[model samples]
Target: MNIVVGVTGGIAAYKTVQLVRLLVRDGHDVHVVPTDDALRFVGAPTWEAISRNPVTTSVHDDVAQVRHVALGQAADVVVVAPATANTIAKIAVGLAGDLLGTTLLATRAPVLVAPAMHTEMWQHAATRANIATLRARGVRIVGPDSGRLTGADSGPGRMSEPETIHREVSRMLAAGADLDGTRVVVSAGGTREPIDPVRFIGNRSSGRQGIAIALAAADRGADVTLVAAHVEDAQLDAAHAHPAIRVETAGTAAELGERMRALAGSADVIVMAAAVADYRVADVSDHKLAKEDGAPVLSLVENDDILAGLAGARRDGQTIVGFAAEMPTDHETVLERGIRKRRRKGVDLLAVNEVGWEAGFERAENAVALIGSDDQVVAEATGSKREVADALLDAIVALRSRP
Candidate 1:
């Protein structure tokens, strides 16, 4: 695959050299296209030497070859690492004076931009609006992670690491051919039930499990969509594509339920990892219920069971996995309880985890067991959410392999 690495003026611009090296080592034909300002950060000789291809900064450099046009036409992927505020704004509005801009304008190849700037520049409404426009046009944006910036700053707006950028590009390129283009949806975080407009019932789910599953799926070359509920959003892995992971957020069981059921037909696998509310106040007031009212009677109604509905209503060839968090117990009890829940959910697999004061839900690390049909413990793993996700995916592939 031919990849064009576009470098812009930013502190992290230096990292693109290493990014180009990685792409070259991975058997990709790498072409370097640096902005005039970027050349100030890293010399043309270094880029040319690393890429083993001539590096250029202008569309007018080679009239015969038409440098900008050829690079765009030849590229399978065009990535702009350390895309400065200026560069992002320029591309967002469709200005094509420079080499990178011309290539982006000229080629329909996938464009991935890894933005790097101060937090102020990144959070500015102008930048935000620009990013939204680019995304709407199907252009990929990687990251400006919340970490150490150019100096004594680090909230957000730092370029994602080079490896991540490279990975996202490769994944997008490999998508249809990889995983045979399997569509997978993962739900994460606990859902909230409104008590009134102000007060609501919710759990302590942190969404780590769902993010782990999404990342793990992407790593294994699966096309993953994350349905994130309550809790703050985490940073996405840039290699799969920037803002690498796609996210859809919902806050209530009713909201998330509608969202999940809508995705059932097209999805090959639906991992129900969210912690949904069982009961919701039937009559939620628009205003906050006054504390002076002396504890009003709050009648509750059962929320829709998303996983069971999917299990019962799934289209042909759909696979579903449900997660059940239980109180702590010995291995024997875990197996027994897990198998029972697996059957009760009517899902192909039920992943059981021990949770209470000291287990799953919002916790960084978790130990889990995978219960499949026939009430069997198909797999068990304990560690980071990423590790558990890998184990779960493995069990899924195993299940698919059998008759």
Candidate 2:
């Protein structure tokens, strides 16, 4: 794949260095094109070294070769990271003054713009109108995430992390895969139950699997909504930054349940991959408990079974998939438990995997059995979380085709 990574003038331009490196490492031919102001934060030399391609900012630099037109013509995808309000407005109005602008004007390939600026600039009427104009013309917008800003202030103006930009670009390149027009809702990460203002009960689930599933669904053209719980900042950014996916956060099992229930009615498929807590603190402390105050006895209460609830309340044609992370005595027990769970919960499919101190939680790779409601083994997947997600989606597509 030939990718043109356009960097604009913004503090977030520094993060595009990683985006370029990721594209290069993925065996894509990446060309870095930065605005003159962008070079102030990250120099041309850095872009050149990472992309292994010469960096440029002006159309005049390679007039003999007509490099601006040639680069855009040959590119499979063009991505603009940290696209400032100024840059977006320029592109929106078809201003072709610089190399990046000219290349963007010349490119017929898909364009993905990730805007980053202060909250005020982003919310300005002119900026919003320009974004609408770009979207009306079919330009894909990634995000200007809501979070901490350039200074002590924070709101909706943060650039998405590099991983997210890379994933969105990948999705654009693989356009028109399966799952087009399908609506998918996926839950990820481990829920955190607060015990006090400063303390909480949480698990080791890094949300890798759930993130993988959400990304996979987006890549396949599904309208994806990721209900995330206690996920890492980078992972959360990646989920929210995708153009095809929407992200919602939940801190506890109750919150996750509410989010899932609300999203389920509108979804064609729901995958409960989150490691939700089975129990929560019965009496949450208003203040942090101190060791000097002697031992504290904690009371626990059961949390609502979100997956079972979805299954029981499912509408016709809705497919609900549940995950069973079990610590079992034997290999047979894993399948047995998964089958039992599938039947008990009345879900269409149950993905069962062995999890312990070192197996599933926080790990990069996993193995799972996709057990059907009839207690039959429908399929098995084992690989990196992304690969497993693809396999799971394949099974889902197959199941959805049945009468």
Best by lDDT: 2
TM-score per prediction, in order, is: 0.56, 0.60
Q: Which candidate leads the pack in TM-score?
A: 2
Candidate-wise lDDT, in order: 0.81, 0.88
lDDT of 1 by residue, 72-151 (tens): 88877889998999999999899999888888887656678899999999999999888876764446788878898988
Query: lDDT score, residue 205, model 2?
Result: 90
Local error of candidate 2 at residue 243 (angstroms): 0.4
Cα lDDT of model 2 by residue, 309-350, tens digit: 999999999999999998777456877878878888899989
Taking all chains together, the TM-score of candidate 2 against the true structure is 0.60
Per-residue error (Å), model 1, residue 73: 19
